[model samples]
Target chain A: MSWTRKHLLGLQDLSRDEIQLILDTAEPCKEIFTRPIKKLPTLRGRVMVNLFYEPSTRTRTSFELAGKWMSVDVINISTNLSSVAKGESLKDTAKTIEALGADFVVIRHYAAGSAKLLAETVQVSVINAGDGAHEHPTQALLDLFTIRDKKGSIEGLHVAIVGDILHSRVARSNIWGLTKMGAKVTVIGPPTLIPQEIEQMGAEVSYDLDEVIPHVDVINMLRIQKERQVAGLFPSLREYSVLYGLNRRRLDQARDDVLVIHPGPTNLGVEITSEVAEDPRASIDEQVTNGVAVRMAVLYLLSGGKDIP
Target chain B: MSLLIKGGRVIDPAGGIDAPADILIEGGQIIGVGTDLPAAKEELPAQGLVVVPGFIDLHVHLREPGYEYKETIASGTRAAARGGFTSVVCMPNTNPPVDNKAVVEFILAEGARNGAVRVYPIGAITKGRRGEELTEMADLAAAGVVAFSDDGNTIMNAVVMRRALEYGKMLDLPLSVHCEDVNLAGQGLMNEGRTSTLLGLPGQTRAAENVIIARDVELARLTGGRVHFAHVSTKEGVELVRRAKKLGLRVSAEATPHHLTLTDELVATYDPNTKVSPPLRTREDVEALRAGLLDGTIDCVATDHAPHSRDDKEVEYSHAAWGMVGLETAWPVIYTHLVLTGCLSLIQAIDLFTRKPAELFNLPGGRIAAGQPADLVLFDPKKNQRVTEELLVGKSKNSPFIGQELQGWPVYTIVGGQARWVDEIGR
Candidate 1:
């Protein structure tokens, strides 16, 4: 199918076919990374802007690399060092970016629906990097790519997303993407950390990680913010690690072929242990590598580039 | 000047009248109500219309004495007049809140000077609404406050709330409480449910409101103080209030038109206008609220007519201010959604807006009989109008109902026998 959508706001609104098209396009994009030069002229002369309202090291850098590899001019505007620090509104900042002639705007804002707001205000194609706890479309896309790459197919795979499900944009987007692609997904976290009525989104809920581990083909662990302990969502780091952390003992109970994945900057001893992270079955590093390819697929499609090289 | 309101279905629930009648007004009072006895010096043609006692909104934020950029007493009262409300009790959450006698007098004076309709100020329960020390309730009541509240800030301290309720009982004024456990509702932007999960916005659980409602009802029973729950939005909250009434406690509750009609599913649009305190709940909650209104478990329909500046609502949903401008849209929305949908009869709905609210707060001007104040609204129930920016007379236009076509808009709002607002287009 020809690309028609101008923005990638969330996985919830995308049709199954649209998601498949994105994943299918990522196949060729992934091949370019193994080449010596790792560059493409398909999107040459296109301008993209990374407008991040929150501090980020990974998603922003991944988008930057995606734009650079595609020969697109990329500009980074961290809010702390820009007009936003002087109290400029999001609308004004988006308009300023549009007036500067950027063709694509990748936004990571601290407020939910900020990316949608920017898309409504500008004529440029917008990609949601992450918007509060709302959605991180690209992160979910890369995750889907990594899963498909490792397991050969996403259909019929039982994936368990464990940890801080209520506050994790990564978890929400993955649930939408995974469910639409015909995966049986289960979200496991403390009852307080799991959002209410999430089963309506086509996911099963569980509190015990070990019980769910034996039945799943993939385990996507979300980072637990230390502030959550202070806010009283959970008791303590030691207690959380004991209850939900993916350590060697829990890994032993999982399927032998089970792939453990994490959206990086993991709390080492909190959600996942050093042994499990370094397990050959763990695809954490490979997920980061797939992130750039998925973003490239997004950038190319949004810019109306078809006939993937 | 003596005036005659000619031939209309006058629904006066307070007087047990619902029939075609002509009202004769003289000296700012209804002198006669029956078949026309004689023509007067002035006449208003009200044929093919339904005339009722003007609406009484128990909760509104005039945003005066401070945040005038959002709404001044002048603009808010004008909007109330256009919405068919003749009397509105303004909440005390404005800057330099109405916690003292001086602030109460200032609001009353400002309302008298610039208001198009009567505006009654509600004094704060705490000084600055800090939920710390209790305000001098007796002094504020003496200064002409119709009630007491610390709306927009729930009294999180049960001890302080109980003390305030004690003082309220002594003063014989109901404390209108905005109930929500702050810690339980932390950083939540919308109702916690399927919609919030799908949208990925932080969800404010219904338990947050229910827990406080449960606490405050016990406190009301303990102190024998009259408690008025503002904008009760959850099913369990409605049930709690129902139980409170069954126990014969001096407790009352109101549901806003938005909460009674809209649901949390609308938040999918990510419109900041839909953001409200106690957020729009599920369809089941809306049904419960409608049931409460029918069974008289909920005392009245309040507008909770909060107004905010455009800048306050034109941003991200999480960053946007809570509340929508309700005064100008309350009647049309309720009329179209509730009355036309058969959830309520015309007279029953009018009673909810008029006599019920007046009786709860013990305010004047909710009846239409000889010697009663001539406050009335005339509207064609069959008429249709789309809510738009131009249709909103309030200074702020943060209404979620904008662009919605609604029937039964008020055409002429007569306050104290004078026409405060007239719809030239409808006429």
Candidate 2:
């Protein structure tokens, strides 16, 4: 029922039960994470690299800390400054990483199947950190861990993944983890940003966030829907917030126990209000804690808790 | 069951017949297609039905076995059903590929077991669709392969393609090359045009597609072999094919439904649905495709019905895959754009959807004839409506023509005398 070592990929279809297993596993790992001289032999002498082509400070740092706590050597490759920036193909970059004797690669490329591409090319294990908004398996697993630690189980959670879902690898990841964990999810956003087929993965599709917020146990807001403005996608950010954003008033309308979350570098006052993020009941910090633990489990499992070959 | 298709303008282009035909079907065969020869025991009475031959698509990517999330043989053949096609030549792009006899047999077995529509597996011209070396064509054709194509990718080496054509001539099978010179298509998101410039993304030029067509046609002449280009989009490609036919080169081309209606103007929208391979061309090129479709220079209108999951499609324009879910929209859009524009008659236009493609690819079952398998479609052309995701039947919904009002809609799709999908009462 628990994750031994499966790389997190797209959350397009992970059920609530499956997500709960990772979450439950993360709770004990969280205790292991918070202790002084936080290090474990579970993954000693194993190596991992966080190759992020896209900037995800919260995700990148959490995975790094997780690997470090697991006593695994972790290297952070900023895709912006690496050979990737120098026009190296993903396969070439993967081969280089593999050649470095790294056992696991946590990649965040800007192409949907970049992780799969890297995984296919490399002999080493590949954990999709976030691939071109394709999937962010670790993020979703951590989100599940947080919810399960706070609420005890994900099965009856009534989770809502709202905003910029079409562009957020995090949304895709969480969908796989949360749905498999047994939570009934409702994806809330403009029809344009929320793709048409998420419901097939067992989530309810909603255009009006106001209608679904009251019924949700957790409201996870993706980054405010990004726009180049000329792509004919989103019109106004101010208007997007008006229709779907979770604010202080909006939170009050929900069940008092309902949790609010932002994957972070929060768009404050856009996807959510400062007040809601700062709320004592908000299990947001716990998610960061769970993120490290979940990633440790991932690294340990992907590396098989062993020394280099 | 006996049937009398009562007040319908039956257009059999192959039979050189165009008039009201009260067709009769019995024992799974079209016993009477023209004016009534004998009274039938069971008369459904097709009152004003545009009964043409059951359609066959020359090109379709029924991604089965490996990439089933996109489309399976069962789902893809179902999509063919919705498109009013009774037979679909499944491209050789399956997981293990229909490149050899064993793969061909497996595909045929799966199609026979699950496909509502007749599925003819097209063997790969090369092993694993890598286009490095040609497959054993004589063996594949013996295994009942309809044709040969490295559909998803082109035969990059002209020498390899010319050899493929030469081998195909020996087997009498056409080497259907997906013509795209990687050099021209490199770093391209959509077509090289105002839209790509506006989007600030790399653009794939028509030269990417055109140069290959011209080179291949010349090669076809040199080799004295047949070459059929799959999904021709560029004007130069069509013009080359047109001239090659005139120059006594045994060459043919199939234009997809998207190329006829959608211009590269759509990629301007930056929606992934508008993003397609040989990326929808300029307005001038679209007009050329439409004109070619009418004049019969373009042999058949095929649906390069590529289905991608939501996650697969919901990305930046440059990063997203180049295809759209076109099975459901192909007929409606073709009806709205070509048929309504005086470009073709209802009879001639329906041929592109039905019999013409069958004749082009040498596939049987395009027409509902005596002793023929009962592959037919019952359509209601007057029902015009906008295409919404809600109405789509396929597993994925990534279409660009969601809001446009389309005139021609298939109400009841019947393949092999079996009703696969029937429209609701209100529809």
Candidate 3:
């Protein structure tokens, strides 16, 4: 149950036993949030730095809150707020941070292999918040945690992931994580938005979200950027929403207990309608809540927490 | 000063000879060859080595004058010598582009001044390689340019390409083309396939290369100008060239060692070293390129020896420069993967490296005979060479073949009767 890896760059390299251990660890961490006194001294003397090259409000804040709750000191170094804007390399910046006695470094970069690059550059335990269209391990871990918590087990579940599979790091991570845990993953998107030969990654590809809804135990909607529309991958937002958007009308086709998840901030009325996103079956808010717990479990285990109950 | 290369299996594809022989060199030319030749001051005993007429690389980028930080005439040719090349035809995609006589003369002068091997300059097909305007083709040809090319960029306009071919036909020079339609290829970092999909990187379809080859073949047919497709990578691209050849069009194609050995799967790791123009293809394409070489479809093997600085390659896959330094690793990779694997005979591989490319440019030194220039390489075909950064002779060590344990190491690279590079172990 002890974490041996110094880095969590991607879920693609993680083992099934290791993934289960992380999900199990996050369960106890989630229970603490339900209590009135939600703080822990697990990493009291530890220092964590969130070095994000890309802008993020949710993931950064969640990791900060997770660290603060564990009594760990957290620092944020975003590109615009630091000397990274002066064109310093990730290597030089990470080395400077590591030299400052950081115990852990959480990085989100616009380059696919930046997290792995930083991991090789520093001695500190590195965690990938997100790296280009590569992976978002904690997001996928929280997603799996939410799915398992709601449905009782991960095995024998059919999960349909809709929207821009080509550019979704979340989809990449989820494809690796969910498939490792025995979930059959169906990636539903337009042909332009779906990467070629994604089936090689152990997932089925589909263009019609409507036809795929009824059979899946879970549907994770990835955010469709306005930039993708500007890049001319699809015709228009209206057409996209009409064709692939999940709404109340489309929700009726799914099983009553089918879970809807979105890695927000959502394109609200485009990929998913306001009605279905706010529906009780939707696990959007729960995913955000579990994100904090999942991050805490990652920090705790990477900081030398033994596998003790 | 004179030298004698004694007792080696000499392979001269153009001369139709592959036998144990002795070569006597004096005044930078072959004076005699056969058993029991007259002795010289310097004797290189090549008992187990295989000797071949100097390897001629038809496509190489000696990034001098403008991008000397990447490579220079001195360093690039030295690296070429280490790779067993006795001569390399420099591509004209330099900063000022070898479009005019001035640049062409400057390249020739620089090569004469610093080159370890014979350096033949290829003039730009169009002015500045922009594809809009044509260069002074007649003047460039008179300046001793072996061929004309805008190697890093394609002539997209059909009319311009046709005109260049017509003019080149009049001048009796080959138009070496870097065939990839930019419109179809668009910002694609790797080959379009399962690997590009799994990695989420943009993919360039094989048709990007095939379409242009098809167009150029027709242009060659129309003008009767010799068209040499540079770094041909796709199966369909090779098929087009093959069909063009069958129809008796003046078309020839060259394949790189990378395209013959590697696939787009290497791009899955996001290694920028694997990023190349006409991007590395699938396994089927590699086999097709190998088969093409064996069946006389691919005329030669050229190391599109593009050298880029460290910063150029140490970036995101999309932002990384599009090339790999092939001159140093070309023979070893080709020998290990193709010849040893029984895909091509040793003489066939030597022909692709020497005679075919020499015939393409009509250059000298593809034949090892009396009175021919003493441009040759003594190769240890079974010698093991592990590619490493420190072992690289070029200024830019951007080869993807690093860490590969390859057979066939050149023991002596003699250019103009002088030893350019001699393996100390062989001594």
Candidate 4:
């Protein structure tokens, strides 16, 4: 299978075959980490720039390591140190990077649709690291890869995404990716954190996670930022923890084979308890590892890697 | 100056006249409106056109004396003339803010010097539109300000608003309001609903505008002040205004041509041109606004012709400035969507743009009979037109209707018996 799109902006517009093709290509990439010579010469001459307007450590580090492991050169540009501090516009910064011959530009911005704006301005391939609450295509791709690797199949699975769905770009991307792969997604969160008309996007919403736990095959817990709760969405953190927190007692209510996942920097006792975070059934570590493999496949395919067997 | 408009279908809603007639104008006042009228120095055969009273936009941002790079009294009124408007009541949210009698006098002087059509200034309801203290409403009225409004910023303090309304009744001027609660509308770039969620932008819920409208309608009832709600964009807002009108309260509301035709679905593209305050709502809201207009719940259709520079609008959706340049497109949009589609009769649509707003603001030029000003627009509804950037006479070309094909085109816009702006169809 071949990947033809010039950019990976979001999972909402991608077809099911295009998604499966990305997963299939990432399968061989996971094997490289086990070898002593972990580097590959697949994209040795390519240059990728990570342009992060918002602060992020895990996603940026994952992309940098993915590029180095494939022997591709990667440069990181945080807005704090760049000319963006001098009031340079996004269009000018993108043109400057493209003029320097970067093959791909991965951008994360505070404004939704900013990645799409950057892609239209430059000639190079673009990847959306995360744009506001918009989408995180690579993260969703990694989640899909991890889910499929563990379950051996993705079709007809019931996945419940819990926590702050309104401000979580991860939740939106997963909703698009998982639903496209024939998974029924139930976004479980407080009404304030769940944007109105989210059901129009083909997701069933439930406020009570306990009621939804028994019917799900996978539970992806999104990290709840303290600032989101400060907007008077809920009473307090302790109250939130008591209401939506996934503890050992609640974990036993699920099926024996049910998998728990969290997009990292988990608030220990806020969204999930310590016991459930390190539970044997949790796939947090696998998601991080698969994140790198999936990004390597994205860079390879976007740089014109023809086919994978 | 004497002028004759021949064989046109004249629709004067104020006079309840809709028939083919020849209007003879003498010294800027209509002398006759009958067939076989005496010949004048200038005569035009307007057989295929429909003549209506000169349109008046109750809301517009001229942006002069400060942000002239975005618009000026000259370019803004020229745009109004091209759109078949004879007068526009300019909003008071300028750089220095039109809070004092001096600013009102300054705007009147500039309008006389450079305006292509009549420009009426609306003084600020609060000092510098800060929403804390009241402006000198009596002194501003004596300075010839047509209305009072703190547009582009809502009067957040309810006590200040009540005092303004109570005092506004004595002056007999309409208190226009830009209804929005900043706390509830926090950081929202678009309307709150399915589209905003799908697009991942912050959403401003309908309650933000609705709650403010509900409060002001009750205040209008209490103070007995003539309250004019500017650019009402939500379904619940229309309902509140409708109920207030039924209760015989001195409350009126206006819906913009943009609000009546477009919905929040357009914001899915994240085009900052669609970014407006009281952000464009759902299709249900648009339908309700149209219904309100037809049933007399919405009294007028204002342009809300806000102008912004290309630099201000070419940025990211969240960073881009709010508003669109609307005067040049308001007529054709209403003509196509509201009039031609049978949602409202032609005469009813024309009255919203003409007599209703003129009477609300107490401005001149609403009628077109003997002893009335020769303010008129000859519109050809069969003309096929497209809105290109070049077709706009305004200083800014940030209109949402830039690429739309519309049905009606104003052939001749005459003010004070002079053909100020004439389209190709008139030739």
Candidate 5:
């Protein structure tokens, strides 16, 4: 299958075939990491810029590594190091990057629809690293790749996304991606943390995480911010950990083959306990490795590189 | 100089007159309104047009005394004239907001010097609209402010709001309020609902506006003062105002044309022009507002004609400023959406724009009769016009109606016996 999209803004509008093609391409992309020389000359002449308005570690590092592994030039610009601190608008910053001959812009902004704005402003391809609570397409693609690698196929699988679904771009992207691939997604979170009309997005909402733990094929836990507690989303972190935390006791109730995943910087003993984070069923580390592979697939496809090696 | 407006279907809702008539004007006042009126020195032929009282908008932001780049009284009033408005009560949200008698007098003087239409300033309810200390309401009223408001900033302090309402009762001036509890509206860029969830933009709940409306209605009942809601955009807000009116409280509300016509679903396009405070609500809320307007729960339709520059709007959805330019598009949009759709009769629509707002504020000239001000509009309901940036007389072209085709444009907007804005193409 051929890839034709100019920008990877979100997973919501992506067709099942387009998503499968990315997953299918990422299979070969993952093999390069195991080789003695982990580099490809396919995108040698391409230049990719990472423009992050919000602070992020894994998504930025993953995209940078993916670009470098493909022999592409990658330049990183965080908010403080760029003119964004001087109050330059997203449009101006994007146009400046385009003027400097950047072929791709991977943006992660705090405001929703910011990536779409950058995509509209510049001629280059855009990959949404994360835009507010909107979507993280590559992260979802990598999650899909990791889940498919373990489970063989995505169809009819029960996937539960727990934690703050209201403000989690990762959960939004996964819900769109997993559901499109025929997975039944049940979003587990506090009622305040689950946004209004989320059922319309093809996910069933459940407040009680314990009831959903045993019935799911995969559980993806989103990072819960301590500030959310300060904002009174929940009463206390101790209570939150007691209620939603995936400890050994709670993990024992799940199916033997059930996989636990997290988009990390995980607050240990908060969303998940130390024992469960290191459990054999946890695929968090593999998800990170697959993140690079999936990103490589996206960068290759968006740069018009055909014939996966 | 005297002028004669000949052969028009006059619709004076205030006077209950809807008939073909000729109106004679002398010295800026109507002298006669009947057939076979004596010919004057100057004559305007209105063959098949509908002649009605000049529109009065209760909520408009002229942006004078500061923020001239966005709009000035001169440009705003010209926009008002083009939209067939002869008088407008400007909000007090300027740079140095209209808090004192000096500012009020300054606005009145500027309006007299540069405005194409009558400009009535609304003094701030609080000093600098900070919602702390109440402004000198008596002095402001003596200085000729038509109303008082802390628009764009809700008076969050309930005690302060109560005191302001008490002063409003003593001063006999309605306090126009911009209803929003900022804490409840935290970081929200659009209405909280399915669309906001789908778009991933932070959602402002309808409770943010409704809770304050409920508060102000109780305060109005307690203080026995007139509290006018500015740009009520939710079904719950309409219901609150409707119930308040039924309880015989001195509470009134105005709905903007954008609120009545547009919905939150439009924000899915991520256009900043669609961003507004009390951010456009659901389709059900729009229907409720229309129903409210029809039933007199919503007293009148105000433009809430907020003007912003391209620099303020041409950015990310979260960073872009709220509000859209509504002055020049108000009449045609209301005409196209409400009048042509049979939701409201031509006369009912005109009454909302004319007599209702005038009577609510006790402003003069809402009807064409003997010894009345000759502020009038000649509108052609069938005339089609496309809204464009170049067509706008206002300095800023931040209107959402740009590029849409609408009908029923005002052919001529006459203020005080003189044609202030004439549609040359229509002529």
Candidate 6:
């Protein structure tokens, strides 16, 4: 019940009541997102360190933007360019970063349980940016905010997060978030990409993306997973695009104003066509805008820096 | 160090001894076991209590190296002590199976570091417990591995079983089998019977486990090897082992607390805690196993001490795990349920707890004997303890026996001449 210093590593850790409270707190953050001057001095002088052990552009930028808007010093330590490339382990790198007075860290790693380990090692509060294909709680939070901001309510709306459900930590995090908010989430992807027990987490799962896209109110298209292509997932990317990819024609088949969403650095034509992405109804920039507010809320909730609310 | 266990009924079954006696223990071995022979420096009176050899269980699941959340050696051994056991054989079904010397040493070192009860780690026969290849038996034996088993999974191939048996005999390593044919028991959740049929759950047949037992018995016979069938649940499996023993082949078996007490009917509730592999069988199976234990056909009762977190068990019954943590409830249940029912004599019950398993595993334990290791369970036999979930020392609360009321509880468990655990001993 007390949202103080607890690890927001995954949405699974949060109960329905806890999630609802987060949504309520994020309601004001969402309001601030659409303002002409979209900034808040909520976390002034706080250091938000982006210790992404894995590479990222979108999630890192979102956290950095959230930090900067709150007047916090943001440090971007990409594992590729940082001292981690010079044989520094994740634990030591985090320790070094923590020693530099990082109040909170938004971490992303390639391994499923990396964030959990880093949390135990450091004294600083950890906001799981993404954990080794396990969870990206802020992404789920932003997605929830985006849906509620557009639809006026989180509950009872049919939401479909489509793509490689197994590899995408976003899909897992979103499933937990969306389901907790009382929305019925249908996960649409290829049979193999659909996790072994998708429905067990209270989400309806389907393999045929075409049948699913027409029914859902919000369609969240995840990135086309290229890592599994060599493992004989599909014949090629073109063939996959033919079956599962969302083209302009696919978008035309949806309801009149169904929100076409993608967590970005989009694959452009693979999961969604450029025509569909640039549509007036996409609200993709709105999602990016809501991302900052949602992350600010997460950092506030975790760092005992829960603003004067 | 010395311990004077005064005024208790000593049941040393292997020596065919019973009745009240005073035990003088020194340097972790029993020095004297009889009526009032010598006055000791430290006299701990055990008046009107049950004094027996420290209990030994041949089978226990200590999930370490990879899955520490389930059961660590520290917690598992602590649970064993709570169950009145002093030595327990840890199964090798870890993430990286205890096939290599490094892993075996790691498990041993953990036991030594904790040093609650003596942990005898059973090395995995196959590398990674894949059931494809065998581990270096000689090398593992040198590193102090007493037995070998792939506990969670079975080696289904006969060629592998035969060769393992032959080579296992060459080094005196007993091949403890988790007897179940994977193909027949494929994806089944519970035991195949009237109950599973009614519940619409896929059930495993007794035939699945028995077929493997029959095959392993033949392999053990062909190679003149010793085979220990672990956690024998089915009526048919026990019958096969009983018959195999009659044929002069070296075959013995262990019955778990669940198999002896619980039945497949609990599966109707759809609780995953009751969901064990080689699933809990019919009441007929339970009765037969109990009868076998009474007549000395079933050798000993082993606690297959499995532990898991709440989330691991919160899922659907078919998807959840197939085990329950039992070390904390073993002695109380066995004593109250079996001994009080006249199914087993108190002395006989004590023997199964001590000498039977100690003799079975060929470990120098499970006796209140002179020159033996000072491993003993100082129990207040008259004390009827009600088991709550809070009573367990282990981190896992996956016990199905919560709120179980039973008589006969261990008060002080002394391992290696020191009091490792003493329930209300000081107070």
TM-score of each predicted structure versus truth: 0.98, 0.60, 0.97, 0.97, 0.98, 0.64
lDDT of each: 0.92, 0.76, 0.90, 0.91, 0.93, 0.81
Query: What TM value does chain B of candidate 1 have?
Result: 0.99
Clashing pairs in 5: none
Task: Give per-residue CA lDDT, model 5, range B1-427, as digits (tens).
Answer: 9998999999999999999999999999999999989989988889989999999999999999899999999999999999999999999999789999999999999999999999999999999899999999999999999999999999999999999999788788999999999999999999999999988899999999999999999999899989999999999999999999999999889999999999999987788889988799989999999999999999899989989999999999988988999988899999999999999998899999999999989999888899999999999888898999998999888888888999999889999988899988535
User: Model 1: how far is B81 from its true place, Å?
Assistant: 0.8
lDDT for model 4, on a 0 to 1 scale? 0.91
TM-score of chain A of 4: 0.98
TM-score of model number 3: 0.97
Residue B151 deviation, candidate 3, in Å? 1.8
lDDT tens digits by residue: candidate 3, A1-309 = 557988888898999999999999999899888889888877888999999989999999999999999999999999997998998878789989999999999999887777877787789999999988879999999999999999999999999999999888999999999999999999998899888789989999989988989999999998988898988889899988888899999999999999999999998889898999999999999999999999999998888786423
Cα interface RMSD of each candidate: 0.8, 10.8, 1.8, 0.7, 0.7, 13.7
Model 6 clash pairs? A111-A132, B28-B374, B28-B417, B29-B374
Position A188, candidate 6: lDDT: 85
Worst 10 residues of 4 chain B by lDDT: B418-427
Scored against the native two-chain complex, candidate 6 gets a DockQ of: 0.02
Model 6 agreement with the true structure over B202-285: per-residue lDDT tens digits: 557788998998898888789999999998888888888888889989988889888888888887555667878668999999
Here the TM-score of candidate 4's chain B is: 0.98
Which tens-of-lDDT digit does each residue in A96-175 have in candidate 6?
98899988888887655566667777888888887655678888888888888788887898998888776688887888
Cα lDDT tens digits, model 1, B370-416, are 99899999988988998899999999999999999999999999999
Q: Cα lDDT for residue B391, model 6?
A: 87
Judged by DockQ cut-offs, the docking class of candidate 5 is high
Which of the predicted structures, 2 or 6, would earn the higher TM-score when compared with the native?
6
Docking class for model 6 is incorrect
Per-residue lDDT for B87-125 in model 4, tens only? 999999897889998888899999988888889999999
